[model samples]
Target: MDPKVITYYFADDGRIPNHPSLPLILYPGALKEKSDRIESIFNENNWRNSWTNGVFDYHHYHSNAHEVLGVQSGSATLQAGGEQGTALSVQAGDVIVLPAGTGHKRLNASPDFKVVGAYPNGMNYNLRRGEIGERPQALEEIGKVPLPETDPVYGTEGPLIELWKHKERD
Candidate 1:
């Protein structure tokens, strides 16, 4: 089945410095029948340095790399875009693509919750809590982080690429 794409935009909000051009992308139930192959799927699409774990409980953002997370085992309530962001519930097979600098935190989760996360081309990622000191530099890094060559869950022609590109052109 084709996955439905959902998009959201989060403003900078002083501290988090959410991506200015790209909106967060969610593909619900994209991998429902193939949750076990999530890692391989991301790797095949050039999203590498994969890890399997639950999200951090505190809000944080990555300044240097975009991130993709595939729900592998259970369910979670994740807050995206810092304190003013949206809270989303996700279960196995859900995939979230967060552009660089988008804030995220795990509000709650099932005991068996597990997700596989990866970055484009195995790019190194930096963790930055919503601290006052991480301002301009984080903003700069976020602007410099390039778009991923391909979507983590889908291949080259996924909704992610189109949505992000369309936003950039606006």
Candidate 2:
């Protein structure tokens, strides 16, 4: 099925300089009851280093890698971008693609809320909570991240590939 895609952009928030070539991409009800399928899709597209869990309850971002989170069960309200970011309501089968340096947090969640998360190229990630001291290193690392060769859910072509490539040209 062609999933509904939504995108969000954030400016440099002093602490977290959200990516210029990437935006937060959300695919609602993309996984549905098939949330377990996320691993296979992510793996096939080179998004390795998988984990199953819920999002953090506090604001944070990763500078070392881009991340993809597939909602396996339950629902939650998530804050993305930064302090001035937008809040999103997510449920089972939903998927969120976070570019390196994009901040995110779990504002609230259902008891059964769970997610499958992974990174492109099996990248190891470091968490930063918008600390002023973390800005320099985070910015450097974020700038070094390469665009993924494939979309986490849509293989080599999809909204992610199309949008990110277009952003690069702008």
Global lDDT of model 2: 0.88
lDDT of 1 by residue, 78-130 (tens): 99998899999999999999999999999999999999999999999999997
lDDT of 2 by residue, 1-102 (tens): 466899988888776677766889999887786787878888888999999999999889998899999998899999998888899999989999999989
Model 2 quality (TM-score) = 0.94
Among these predictions, the greatest TM-score belongs to 1
Q: Distance (Å) between predicted and true CA of 146, model 2?
A: 0.1
> TM-score of every model?
0.96, 0.94
Q: With candidate 2 superimposed using the best TM-score fit, by how many Å does residue 159's alpha carbon deviate from the native?
A: 1.5
Q: List pairs with backbone clashes in candidate 1.
A: none
